[model samples]
Structures are given as C-alpha cells and as structure tokens.
Target: MLKELEKEWTENDRRDEVASQDRPVPWTLLASLAALPIAAGLFVGGFFWWRGRPARGALSEEIAGLSMVSPWVIGFMAFTAFPIFLSLALSFCRWSSLTTLDHAQFVGWDNFRSLFGKDTTFYHALKATALYALLTVPTGQLAALIAAMLLNRESKWIGIFRSIWYLPGVLAGVGMSVMWRWVFHHEHGLFKTLIDPMMPAGWHFPAVFEKDAETWGVPAFAFINLWTIGGTMMIYLAGLKGIPKDLYEAAEIDGALGWKRFRNVTLPMLSPVLFFNFIIAIIASFQVFTQAYVMTGGGPGHATRFYVVYLYNQAFDFHEIGYSSAMAWLLLLIILGLTLLVMKGTKRFVYYEALKA
Candidate 1:
C-alpha cells in the first residue's frame, strides 16, 4: 500500500512538470488582448472626429491653438500618461528590472499585502516620511513668510538681500547634501564645534549621522530646510504685493493695530496664497529623498529610511520592482487623499473672493 501511494505521488509530479514544460506564457496574445480596448478607443475617437467635422474656416483658430500646444500634449501622453498606466499595471505583477516585461508573473494584491501585513520596514519608512513632512512643512512656511514680510519693501539693497536668500535654493541638491553631511559630522563638524561647548558636562550633542541620530536626524534636515526657504519666500513676497493697501488702511481705521492688523487684514487676504503654499509644501515634503539618501542611505539601520528612498531601494537594491511600483502608487494615493482633506478642511478659511458667490 505504501509503495502504491508513493508511485501515485511520483506520477502526479511528473504529469505537472510535463504540463508546465509543454506550455509557455502567451505574452503576445495577452498584449494583443490588452491593446484591444485602446484600439477601440482610437477607432471611436476617429469616428467622432469624422462625424463632427466642421468647416475648416470655423476651426482655423482651434487648429492653431491645438497646433501650438501639440508638443506639450504629445509629450504628456508619451512621458507622463503612458508611464503612469504602465506603473499601475506593473504594480500587480512581479517583475524585475533585469527581466523582460513578458516574464512578469501576475500576483494581484500580493505586493500590497506584503507592504501592509508584516513589513515593519514599510511602517518605519512611512513614519519617518510623515514626521519629516510635519516638521519641515510648517516650520519652513513660517520661516519663509517671516523672511518675506521683512524683505517686502523698496530699498537699494532689498534686491541684493532677496538674491542672497534665493541663492541657497538654486544650489545642487547632492552638493548641498554632501556639504550638510560634513557640517553634521559626528565629532569634528561645525555643529559640534559651535554647540558642544555650551553643553553641560556629560551631556552630548545629538550627532545626526552617528549615535542617537534617529532622534535628531529629521530635525537636522528640517533645519537644513530653513536655509532653502528662498522659493517659499518669493511666493509669499508675491502674495504680499498683491494684497490691497486699502485693507490695511481700513484695519487701521478700525483700531486694528500691529499683529491685529496682520491677523485681520493680511491673513485673510493672503489665505489663498497660504493655502497654495501649504498644498505644495505637503506634496514636496512627502517626497523627500535626495538629502536622506545621500547623507544616510537610509541607515544606521533604516532609522532615516524615507518613503521614496525605501521605494527606490526595493526597486534597485532588492530588485523588487513590483513592490516598488506598488509603493509609488500608494504614495500617489496618500498624497491625493491628503490634498483633498486639506482642501476640505481649509475651504471656509481660504479667502477666494470670486468663489464667495
């Protein structure tokens, strides 16, 4: 009986192996089936164009408009739209950069499950990213607004000051990262030299690249962020210039002075700009990668592994292209959700005069 059972199992394994050997994945057929909808869409579009064809004279300007913008539209379709849809499809399939697309084994929801299920690294990366965004966005905005307000004046040296402030922003990101690494060097960096002497005995400065760096790393990045407030400052300066002076005059008439005038007049008028900057800051902050990647490589044991950097490592370092693609899509969803939430929360506070109707 045992010999007969072993014989049956061996036969079943042989049959399964032969079945797999006899058939290969029909990627060509799959591709054709996948393209059928796109082909149908193009056909419908062509039909509509022919059916709704108007006199050339009526559409000359329209044609001219489309012709003028055709380059951008074409570029967007090729570079942006195509890759977006490709990534969406790839997210569901297990493929590596080293392998052909045809070799991608479809494993729907598995990548997402892994990310959410037992992947502690994913959670850590998410936490680091969220914390960095929270710490940097508001602080950077406040610093930028203050600098803008101080510089919003007519003077011979005002432009010089503006240029000086903006210079840091235009510097190469990797170069800046390298520079900051040295500035935060564990023992001999500028920070240690400047901050160590003031400390009491037995107290140590939080060396951002070394011991207990996790506690101080994100904050150090936030401090580095303050130095690159030039872009935000320019935007705030533009918003300040746009505010009607009469509003300030009215505030003065109403006995609203100093901070009261700013709160009542400046803030309401500038709310739209603030809203815009807030949205932009959130988007940019969540995608923070270069500085962390260059400085730490998400290390001292994944302490500073930010979202994008983690995604990057999954793709290139671990060869988990499918997982990384899922991570990218998840990030898109998160950003979109946050943006919508902020818009909903701030709608009443944002002073869109035209929208008041």
Candidate 2:
C-alpha cells in the first residue's frame, strides 16, 4: 500500500511539470521590451540627421537650435512660468495651500486694498526697508570707495590686503548674521565689552539690540552691512585701476591739486562703476532679511521689520499666501519704479566711455 501511494504522487508531479511547459508566454510584454531599443534607435537617428542636415538660412539654424533647447523651454514653462502666473492669480483669490484649488474663493483686489488701507504693519515694514536702504546704500558705497582708493597700489602686499578686506564679504549671510547677534548682545557682548570701559562713571553704551532699536535700528543694520564692503571695494578697485594715468597727468598739468584732480578725473572715470554699484546696493538693501531676522526678529516695536520678513511672516506664520503674493508684487513694483527713477536721474552723471568717445 505504501509503494502504490508513492507511485501516484510521482505521477502527479510529472503531470504538473508537463502542464507548466505547455503554458503560453505573454507576447504583449515581450513585444514592448523588443520595441524599446527600436524606438530609441529611431529617435537617435532622427536627431543626428536633423543636426547634420544643411540649413538653408539663419532662420533654419535658429529653428534647429531652438529644437535642441525645447526640453529646457518646456521645463521652464511647467515649473517657473506656471508658478508665477498661478501666484499672480492667487494674489486676487482667498486661497491656502492646505485647501483644494476648487475651494479657492475669488477676492479680486481685496488683499491689496487691505494691505494699503488696513495694515499698519505693511506700512511699518515699508518704512523700515526704506530707512535701511537710505542709511546703508550711500554709507556702504562711500566706505567701499575709500577702501578701494587706499588699497589701489601695485605693491607685493596689496594682494594680501585685498584678500584680508574681502574676507568679511565672503563670510556674509546667515552665519555672519548670527555672529553679529552675539557681537551686539545687550550684556557681555563684544561691542558692549569694548565700549563700556571707555565710558565715564555711570555712563553706558546705547542698547542697540533693545527698545532703543526703534531709533537706532536702521543705522545699526547699516553698520553691519558696512562690514561686507569688501566686494564693493573690489569693484571700485577695478574701476580705479582702469582710470587712465594720462587723465591725472593732464589734470596736474592744469594745476588741479589734491581733491580737484580726483573730482574731475577719478570721479568721472569711476562714474559707471559707481552707478552699477548704486543700483545693486539699492536692490540688495531693499531685500535685507537675514541680519534683521536673526538679530532683531523684527522686534523693538517692529522697527526692524523689513519688507521681506513681513512677507515671510504673512505667507508662513499667518498662512496668508494671497496677501503675501500681493506684497511680493508690490515690492517688485517698488524696485522697478526705483530702478527706473535712478536710471533716469543719473543718466547725465553716468559718463559712458564709449559715448564720450
């Protein structure tokens, strides 16, 4: 009986093996796998042929070049262009990222109206940003120009001095801001330690990081920015180097001494670099964020509340994405208007060498 049972089990296993061998393979999957290489080959061949083909005109060459960049163009449209337009649309709608698109309500110009008419913080942020730009831009430029003039020599140690001066600008951003926070600390801070001893008995240094920041915030921030004048100084140095020595010779021959030669020759020659730096400084000053955010946290009764910090608070902290978008657009408009005004106002002063020639 045991032998007969074992024989039956063996027969059953043999029948299962035969059935597995007779089963059909999936032709659809096999065809798809086979077609992949053919499709790839055809695409590659077509691309090479198009590239190697002789173009009839400049337009044809341009079209071919554009075709090669079609992928980047598509990506930019999908990622950058779409988001920009969506943000602009959302600026007019009451929407939150937490909600579905279908739930977004049309609010037209309500966001803009509220910011202008109702929000005091918006105005305060604008004022603070304007104040920061006013204090930092001219002072920073002047300091950088002076440093550049002082270091504009062809000595062996000049490169070392340039590198030393440039170190601060290179060390800018969040890390620098955090360092400044410690430096400006109310008690046991670097500035306090240095200035406290110099004061008379019972006299104290100004509380730069405290309530007095309402009066001193912008200037303090400007002082911090002044530390990073290395970059601007390098630009000024380059401009100074480019000024023809012949101009100085001519001025000296005309009995122009001391400040007179500088006013006539160096100032006009460096005007283009000055204008470039001015525009960059203005834009950068308007967008000041890191130091104010890290050091003051927009504190001292919103005295250091920069426009960007306010925008960030609205978008993330308050979950007012629509309002933030409106603020961003407003800031863009302000920068654009200021840039245009500056360009128009300084057109006469900006002496272009090519134009003069």
Candidate 3:
C-alpha cells in the first residue's frame, strides 16, 4: 500500500511539472522581452554621449536653443501634425461624425473613387471653383497693381487714401457681406440707384441679384473682391518703393517715354513681385469660401458653389467627415500641383536682381 501511494504522488508531481511548462508566458516576462531593444538603445546612446563629452558645451547651447523653441514645436506636432495624420487616416475610413471613433471601418479608396467617379456635385464644384479663380485672381491683381501705382506717390493725402482702400479689407467677413447684399439689392441697391439716372428713360439695369445671379455670380464676386484690393495693393506698393530710381533715370536718358519706361523698366523690376502676388492670389482664389458662403450661400442652382464651400457643406452640414477629408486632401494636391506648375513656368520670366549681376 505504501509503494502504490508513493507511485500516485510521483505521477501527480509529473503532471504538475508538465502543466507549468505548457502554460503561457507571464506579462512580466513579455514586457522584459519587448524592452530588451530599448535597453540596448539606451546603452548605445550613453556610450556615444560619453565619447562626445568634449563637445558638451556646444551640444548644451544647441539643446538650450531647442528648448527655447520646444513649446512651438510641441504645439505644432500636437495640433497640426497629429490632426493632419488623423485626418489622412480618416480619409481612408468610412466614418461619420455622428458615430464614435471606435465604429470607424476601414474603407480603402471608396471615398476618393466616389468623388472622382460617382459624385456629380464634385465636378460642378470644381468647375465653379476654377472659373471663379480664373475670373477673380487676374482682375483683382490688376486692380491692386493699378491702385498701388496710383498710391505710390508722395502726398499728404496718401495715408488717407491708403486707409480708405484698406478699410474694406479689414472690415471683410459678415459686415462686408451685409454691405454687398445691400449694394446688390435689385431695386433699392446703391448700384441700381446710381446707374438708374445714367440710363435712358426706358432702359433699366439688369437684375444683378435676381434673374442674373446665376450667370453673373462669378463676375459679381470678382467685382466685390476688387473692393478689397488693398491687401495686394500694399504688397505691390512695397515692391514699387523698392525699385531703384537709377533705372528710371537711365530709361529717361535713353529716350524711353512714359509707356516705354513702364513697360521696359518697371515691368521687369516688378516681375518678382507680380509673380509673388499672382501665386498668392491664385491660392486664395482657389480657397475662396467666406464671400460665397456668406453672400450667395452656394445658391442660385449651385452657380456660386466654390470648392471650399462644398467641402464645408460635406463635413459640417452633411456629416460626411471621411468624404470631406478626402476632398480637403484633393484640394491640397490640386493647389500644390498648380503652385509647382507656376514656379516651373515662371522660372525664366521671374527676374532676380542678384542673378542679373
């Protein structure tokens, strides 16, 4: 009986040992395994640090400068970088703002495909945006250049004129929208009122706000944008001021009259500024939202629907967060491509004073 009991006890011990061997590894062991590479990296980094101890003061100065700017770096990473990555991830997801992030399902290229293939509104918005940009950017730049030329003179009233021109830009947004709405009011508007007297007895101005809004919407916006030419005017004015007086004197001595002098001397010297303003205007025109949103609300049969307005409607109004993100990325790509094209095309024409020497 004692032998049989000992045999049973030995068999039970063996089973216990086998069970221990077969069991899954503990969390502690798994953590240690994961941290092995990290520990090695730290050791290697310490060795390098010790080897470079002679340059410690220079390193310390660099570190101090980095520390001074660390807050901005941290803020940019947290706010801008994180959001950009998150938005990019979400662009490939089937997500609605109505649901939580946990419910987001991975949807490969459906958002982009839908936009390019299925969505008719997307094409219409793109067309409208392109047309708007084409109309507004050049006209606005021309207006600004003219104003800059006029205001570049030295006079006591120059500041007042500058203030008057810039005031509209400063008071943009809702207030400007309201003013425009009043100005374009079909019957009672300042535009109609002023034009009424000049017209023949039977002739009347076309309804800019009513029947003509669909066809004339872009032109109307371009006109309104012309009012805020002050910002671009300032940039052009700065460029004009920077042009050397010697160039004008040389042109005059060479018998280059007003138009010739302006065409030859002024245009070449101002090419760089013009290129800068052109690029800025193009970008701003592509991303035009406020006036279209506030004034027309992308209305009158989607005639005034700009790209950003469409994106805004998709994200906020329609709750298509994923689709909106896709649109945003597409817009970014479009702008980037256009900017690169502009840069490449203008490489020969863009005058650099340093390069001339």
Candidate 4:
C-alpha cells in the first residue's frame, strides 16, 4: 500500500510540472499594455533632448507628453494652482456676500487696506494670537524637553508611564475639548471647587465667564490648550530614546553632572528634535481652532481669536469669500515666512549626528 501511494504522488508531481511547462505566458499581454506609455515617454524625451531640432512634430510631441500627465496636471491646476491664483486676484478686489462671483469688481489694495486700516478687530485678534503662540510655544517645548529627559532615564515601566503621559493626546477631538470645557467650568467645575475652598467667605471663586472680576484672572483658554499638548511631549520623549546612551556615559566620565551633561550633550544632540517641535508648536498654536471654537467660539470678546477662527468667520459666517481668500493668503505668507526663518536659524543650533551617521 505504501509503495502504491508513493508512485501515485510521484506521478501527480510529474503531471503538474508538464502542465506548468505547457501553460501560456502573459508577457505578450503585459508588453502590449506597456508599449504605448513607453513609446510616448521616449518620444517626449527625444523631443526635449533635441530642443532646437524640435521644429517637426513639436505639437504632436507636446500633445503626447500632456496626454500622459493630463489627469494629474489638470487636477493640480484646478484644485491647487488655479485656486491660489484666484485668491491672489481676489485679494485685489472687493466682493461681499450679496455680490455675484462675476460681479466682483476690481478694487486694487482695498481689501488689504480694510484689513490694516479700519479693522481694529483683526489687529486685536492678531495680537492675541501672537501672544498665545509666545506663551504656548516656549512652554510646550520646555514641557516636552523635561518629559524627554525624565523618560530617557533607566526605568522598567517607563513605556507604561510614557503611554499615560500621551493619553490626553489620543482622546477624540470633540471629546477632549468637551472634557476640558467641563474642567474649566466656572460655577461647579473642578477648578472652581479647588479654589473656592481656599478662599474666605466674602471672596467667591470667579468663573471664566465673569470677565469683570479681577481676583480670578486666570487665562482658562491657555490652561485648556496646555492640557491637550501632552501628546506632543510624548513625541519628544520618543526622540530622546533614539539618542545613544554611550554619549551620556562619555559625558559622565568627563565629570559632567546633571546640568552640564544636559547643556553640553543632551541639548546639542536633541537640537533637531527641539527645532521640529518648536516650529510645529508655533504653527499649531497660531492656527488653534477646535478648542477655541468649541469652548468659547472666539468669545469672552475674542479672547481666543486665533487666525484660523478669524478666517473661518470671514469665509462662512460673514460670507465674504474674497475677503476670506485674502486672509488665507496673508496667513499662508505668514506661515511660509516663519518657516523660512526657522530653517535659516536652524544652522546655528541644530546638531546633525555626523559622527554616528
């Protein structure tokens, strides 16, 4: 019985091999499908390579070249490039909600004039947003740096603690904002309860809504923001883990203690990470929307009047699309300028690990 089974298996394998050898190849079908694109690319390349010799069949070559990238090129022009141009054009015009798109009369520099001249709200909001960025960016970087240092230390359950620190960041956006709003609730919130007990009978705990009160003058908006930025801190902690322990050991051998090791070794090594987090934090803080929109609606008289919120109000609520486009362009310029400044400044401080690489 075993001999018969072995013979049958051997025969089956032989039959499978024969069938595989006899099967038709798919190279013809693949080659046929690939030939058209390959031919077109070669033609376009040849055309560009011999630019002066491109008098003949230039239009045909251009057409063929465009045919390949038509979908992407068209989409890019329609969605991105055209819109940017349109916004730029719109910034030079004056248009309101009631005005038709075609009826947007050209009024050069009018919108920009309005932004800087009569618009005191824009000035106030911009100042407030700048102040928020100043407060949040430095503080957030310091917090992340401290967390990174703490987590870099040798510990068994460091991963678990790291997750705990990052937990606030993963909370659903709406849920996190709502949770923060509750914590900042003036009358019966945790913050109020904490402060109320310590105060005397005559002096009551002031709510966030009570703008008139001088005693409870805490900026609740800023507190809410800081609470949600714990996730960014975790990212820095991870960056710290990627650093070599040997560097620290070398520093210690050189008689470097806590502050010295941190200043000379840790700070220089982590400069790239710090630069990344600082720029990101600045951009995010400037465009702060969700927390302010959900919690305050840029209220308490525009206390949380972030740049994006202002843009959103201009676009949607005011129905000033042209004006909003102008604002968007201004913001784009601002962010681009700031990013360029960061890149330029990074050369002085950011330490790339060329020795290790």
The 10 consecutive residues of candidate 4 with the worst lDDT sum are: 13-22
- TM-score of every model? 0.89, 0.80, 0.82, 0.75
Error (Å) of candidate 1 at residue 260 is: 1.1
Global CA lDDT computed for model 1? 0.82
**Residue-level lDDT tens digits of model 1 in 135-209:** 999999999999999999999999999999999999949999999999999888998899999999988677887
* lDDT values for all models: 0.82, 0.80, 0.79, 0.69
> What does candidate 4's lDDT look like per residue over 1-357, in tens digits?
223423542343211122223332233454566567768988998887767545558867866887989999889968998678678866665455676665555555656766776565577668777877777777767876787678777778988877777777677387887876677677777878898889988876666744621222125555555656666787677677777889889998999988999889878877887888888987887787887777666665655666787777767766666667878888888888888898898878888772252
State the weakest 10-residue window (summed lDDT) of model 3: 13-22
- Candidate 2 contains a number of clashing pairs equal to 0
- Alpha-carbon RMSD, candidate 3: 16.8
Q: After superposition, how far is residue 225 of candidate 3 from its true place, in Å?
A: 0.4
Better of 2 and 4 by lDDT: 2
Winning candidate number (lDDT): 1
Runs of candidate 3 exceeding 4 Å displacement:
1-56, 197-204, 354-357
Query: lDDT tens string, model 3, 71-102?
Result: 99999978997678668866776556897765
| Least well predicted 10-residue stretch by lDDT in candidate 2 | 13-22
- Model 2: per-residue lDDT, tens digit, 1-357? 223423442343211122223323333554577568768987998898778866589658867798999999989978987677667766776655576655555666777887787667778999999999999999999999999999998899989989999999998988999898888888878988999999999987777879578887778999999899999999999899888788889998999988998888889889999999999999999999888888877876677889998887767765667678888888888999999999999999989982243
Best model number under TM-score: 1
